[model samples]
Target: MEGLFQRELDPRWARTANNASHWATGVLAGAQYGLVAGSVARPRIGYGVPLGAGLWGTGYAVLPAAGLYRPITSYDRATLAKDLGAHLLYGLTTAAAFAALGPARCRARKAG
Candidate 1:
């Protein structure tokens, strides 16, 4: 078990793991937006819905790339509550849009 765990922990695997997860998450997110937009059952939700999805998807994809992107305004209880709520709201909107359309470029690195 020790050897098995060590093999799993190899740094080379990290690159592969992150890249695959990133792209898979991206595509699924786009599909999510497509589903949501379709659920409206309205013919009028054409460009805006899809466009918004793309914006959201891109935001999601790029967010991780930029590093810890969560913005916490303050640690005070009152301020923290407000910040948390706002961040959650922003996160949901960002996720919805990304799941709708964003797909970041991903390429697995060859072993060296």
Candidate 2:
């Protein structure tokens, strides 16, 4: 994962620090996704799928422009498929966790 990210970065920034930064970025991204998922009313698999897919689509458009990652078109089919699969999995897992936590439902339950 680090190697892949490093490849897209400028030579000066392509070092251990950048790899660590990438890992940190991933962690932060996961947290943001969790927060979004948790805020949903009923957090189900259906909800997660679209949320994750939307995020992936948005990242493809934004990340390259931001210089964080390469454009989706630059990657080969296998890499693109792998990334899509990973994003889907991340979304599904986040939704499952959110459903289990049931933040919105719990709030409603308590209020009622």
For model 2, the superposed segments whose C-alpha errors exceed 4 Å read: 1-40, 103-112
Provide the overall lDDT of each model, using Cα atoms, as 2-decimal numbers: 0.46, 0.71
Q: Quote each prediction's TM-score.
A: 0.32, 0.63
Which regions of candidate 1 deviate over 4 angstroms? 1-7, 41-112
Return the TM-score for candidate 2, rounded to 2 decimals: 0.63
Best by lDDT: 2
Total colliding residue pairs, candidate 2: 0
